[model samples]
Target: GESFDPRSSLYLYGNGDGPTSTATIDFAAATGTEYADEVENVSFRINDIDWGSGNHTDVVTVNAFDA
Candidate 1:
């Protein structure tokens, strides 16, 4: 079992006023404990502020490697 809190390590940048925004997460910089033999599941929760009225879309990607 393993767990990490990405709040301190995650960085978000890019033009919010524009059509797109980008968020980058640095797992290496994260301040937490992690231990896992195999990744059985992954989850993400995104929060937005002052999102105006319009159709919006979200895309998420995760990269994993065997150690």
Candidate 2:
């Protein structure tokens, strides 16, 4: 399921390689204000996360909309 409201808040997405480590996603909004800007791919970085004991891959989905 997607977050109910993503535009007004900061959406953090992530994925994990294994139980040893995890990855984080970073996004750059077209502009600082959510209402006056469009969303773009920006970029992402991996951060403290877990991949569930190397058994399955973790994926994070972000839901963004015009505020």
Candidate 3:
């Protein structure tokens, strides 16, 4: 197997027809260290209070879009 790591993480954003909704990621506020790889399983957890009052549950996954 090969090892893969991410230098930095990018903010995932989503756009809607009515308004432009955004997600705030506080990687710095994370209690522990997080790492990513181009190939492998990944996961994400939201600990920020500013996200919302409702369940902000999510499934973390990454995929390669280009060769």
Candidate 4:
């Protein structure tokens, strides 16, 4: 989605048929330490996409707030 941050993106090289030489990342170095069972709730949205294909699926749960 448009709101998904570029910094948090996962890149895969040699998927074949790309613009040019793709970049890579070291996942092990990225995820440091063992799981601490730390759970946090965050809000995200999907936008600017053509859902006409209906090829993917996801359940969106919105948090209602009164202002």
Candidate 5:
């Protein structure tokens, strides 16, 4: 269910936490030109463990550097 975004950094992702705040993710410091040089698939931990044993696939993109 991955789609494309022209201005990804302008958008914010929430509720990345898994099951009662087991996991939390944050996106910052984007350096992309119209979604090209973006940071994809930022990593996080689930209750200090693996994210749902690879069952979860939550990712974010960084695209703050634009004209």
Candidate 6:
């Protein structure tokens, strides 16, 4: 398992007028260190979703690599 700074967070806000939205999070910037070369697993914690109405649905997609 790995640990990250509790204060580290990435937020992306979309205007709700587009079919898709995108953002990038630099792990080195967020953790103050580069990701290890052998890393095989990564995880994310998502919160504070603003489902304005009861009929709204959201999909989250994440892509990670050793760039």
Cα lDDT tens digits for candidate 6, 1-67: 4667789777676555544557776544435556553444567777766555653556677776665
- Provide the lowest-lDDT 10-residue window in model 6: 28-37
> What digit string (tens of lDDT, one per residue) describes model 5 on residues 1-67?
4454545433233454444332333444567535543466554222222345453545443343432
lDDT of 3 at 11: 55
lDDT of 4 by residue, 30-56 (tens): 257675434344444444322233333
TM-score of 2: 0.23
Global CA lDDT computed for model 5: 0.41
Best candidate according to lDDT: 6
lDDT per model vs. reference = 0.49, 0.46, 0.40, 0.38, 0.41, 0.62
TM-score of each: 0.29, 0.23, 0.19, 0.23, 0.20, 0.43
User: By lDDT, highest first, what's the ranking?
Assistant: 6, 1, 2, 5, 3, 4
Which pairs of residues clash in candidate 5, taking residues 3 or more apart in a chain or in different chains?
Answer: none
Candidate ranking under TM-score, highest first, comes to 6, 1, 4, 2, 5, 3
> Can you give the lDDT of residue 32 in candidate 3?
57
Model 1, 10-54: lDDT tens digits are 544444445466555433423464754444455664455444455
Candidate 6: clashing pairs of residues: none
Best by TM-score: 6
Residue-level lDDT of model 2, residues 1-67, one tens digit each, is 3334345444344454434433353444566665543445444443444355555555555454553
